[model samples]
Target: MRTRTTLAAAGLLLTLTACGGDTDDKPSAPPSLTEEQRASARAAAGLPPEPSTTARYRFLEALNDIDRRIVDGKDGKDDKAVSRGLNQCRSIKNAAGDEDKQVALVQQTLSRFTIDTRLPDIATPETGGEILAAVHKNLCPDF
Candidate 1:
């Protein structure tokens, strides 16, 4: 469970850079996971990787960075971060399946991000538990 939670947090950091938006001179290459690492990730998430788990991991790292920026109160970073995170999040959601169980998994993950990071309240959520609850409420009210 702990491993899965950590992977979920990492997944949030998965970013647009993995989506071919790098501005560097050299094109970025996807990372290859070792058998142990891949098995750990699979066991953690209890789901096999899509065709692009490397991209997902990179995206999670990026999201983690953006989340730090948000915590630091960087100007105009929230919008960009949230937009990008939401995009990856939607991909995650779609991959997980559009069902109540899937929504619960996402809810677990959002809570894990806050708990694992010890993030201070910054928005209408007002508290970590509330943040998770509100995200669960707003993101998938039907569930």
Candidate 2:
């Protein structure tokens, strides 16, 4: 069982950390939303909340173990990669235990994580399904 206080604290830290780095003259991109907002949106969509900050880092570390591309460059602080992984969790939660749904989400999201890196693409549903399993275990376990 988890506590609301813990979740709120983690959300605060995530927002704080995610707020760092220069935004001045930063190229326009999708507007950023805080972790709490993201989580609320996920919940509104009928998905489960993401893990704590510690768990998220652990999740990234586990994915890094599976393939370098997942965390290539930026030394695991790659915001895009991390978001991509968390988005996987959202879809995976919605997927429930349906193997095909999970596999398809992997196909859609996994390639984006791997492409453009020096490493070969980790896009295959077979491999992606395995990697997404790590996301499930660390961040969004069965509920």
Candidate 3:
């Protein structure tokens, strides 16, 4: 009986560890992008020339900052910031009539992250490409 109890307790402990406890929290590392990768991604996407080196860095900084915030559970702030940034990007594409390539590139990049669509009032990218396509459609339907 004691042996059976010990085995059962061990099994329970293993199950709990595998199940990740009652909380859904999982640890994750911060998101980052290298300068070369950023430049390559922008070039592949046919982005407009950077206003300046500072401007280019600012754009990437903003993206990483928001990504970290989202991962840290700052959902409301993240949503608002991402929405604004995406809208601005869309506006630029619309004005330049260069939406398609940008959308495709963004879709490719966004695929690196896990999208959560179950949240309230959120229309997350099912794939990185989908979000980019949607943004293009919304901002520059002509493209």
Candidate 4:
């Protein structure tokens, strides 16, 4: 009986740990990028040539990744599906109302598509751009 109880406790601990309770609440700073990398991402997103701050650069990088994945034909082209998820994500970010919170929300939102098995179809580049736009419309419409 003691052994069984010990095993049960161990299993419970393992399950809780696997639930990702250790996730950081703080968002990490975006990585620094070379001018070429920034330019490439900007070009991919059709932005004008100019210096981009960390937030803009990270957003562009995320957009570029989606665009690249779409061109590579890795996912389906269901814009509506992507739009729905992105809209929800955008709402979450808007409610957060701070740059760090928004960044955290975006990271969490995007990570769900990759990590959550039961999530709906992944977003393609076009869909990803649309999703970004949805969020940016509220957060940085001029960006």
Candidate 5:
């Protein structure tokens, strides 16, 4: 997961640089960072890699698109959201399809985000339910 995210960042940089450079001197080839090197690079940037497949990445992207008062799209905070999201998925799976348990798990997980929702502090249960629905539809359809 971390590798993929780091690669994404690095890939974007490589693509941008490769797109256009000095018209005089040829652009130098980009160095491919090893796993440890990539991990260090990601750590330096403080961005968490997307978890699981491209589906989960898209899910989080869509989730962040909402005004859910979360900072998952930010640099330092995205990792926490990814970690909490993956954790919630595992917890929901462990709940064995119990709706109440799943809802509660999501509510608990919501505390992990830096939210600025309609509520004063915590997000509404309805919001949590919506998040859970997205999770089910996106991350854990089997659950």
Candidate 6:
């Protein structure tokens, strides 16, 4: 009788443990883009290399730089960094061909720029919208 009771309790405990544990059945998310991949994409697209340092490719580069900085956790104490970057990005509305390609690259980079671990939970949505608005203004200023 004692042996049977011990076996039944052990079986019940095993069943409970199995039911409470997580399953390995779900698929994991894809890996994120590497710095080299991002740089290559920007270079192949003829966009500015650092985005933030130069004013010749002003608009697009600024956007790319700002996005890169924010995503790379380099956004410093300057609040105007975002606005300044956006302003530069907004300045290239009339560019054509390679210039336009760079602008498009900026737009693409911004579109893919994710704030996942860098931003505060409450500020993420608003910041993203602001970035999107900046991109929109650059792409289509009149709207």
> Which structure among the candidates has the greatest lDDT?
2
RMSD of each: 18.5, 16.9, 14.2, 18.2, 15.6, 14.4
Give the per-residue lDDT digits (tens) of candidate 6, residues 1-143: 99999999999999998887567767689988898988787555544344343332343444455454553435542334444444434333334446555545444333444344444352354555455555544433442
Better of 1 and 2 by TM-score: 2
Instruction: Give TM-scores for every candidate, taking all chains together and pairing residue i with residue i.
Output: 0.28, 0.56, 0.25, 0.27, 0.50, 0.25
lDDT of 2 by residue, 1-143 (tens): 37988999999999999988976866779989998899789888755675678877787778778775567657545666666666676777777788787557766555655643334455566666667777678767763
Q: Tens digit of lDDT per residue, candidate 1, span 44-134?
A: 6533333244443444344444345333446765444343333334435454555665545444444545433544443222333343333
Candidate 6: regions farther than 4 A off: 1-68, 71-111, 118-123
The local distance difference test score of each candidate is: 0.45, 0.69, 0.48, 0.49, 0.61, 0.49
- Model 2: lDDT of residue 97: 85
Candidate 3 lDDT tens digits, 68-131: 4333346465445344434445344544645675555543435333334322223244444444
Which wins on lDDT, candidate 4 or candidate 5? 5
Ranking by lDDT: 2, 5, 4, 6, 3, 1
**Candidate 4 structure quality by residue, lDDT tens digits, 1-143:** 99999999999999988877556667789999998998688556544344235544444455445544422333543333344334444445355557766555544544544422332356334453454454464324443
Q: What are the clash counts of all predictions, listed in order?
A: 8, 0, 1, 0, 0, 1
lDDT of 5 at 53: 73
**Candidate 4 clash pair list:** none
Where in model 4 is the C-alpha error above 4 Å?
Answer: 1-66, 70-76, 112-143
Worst 10 residues of 4 by lDDT: 111-120
Using TM-score, give the best candidate's number.
Answer: 2
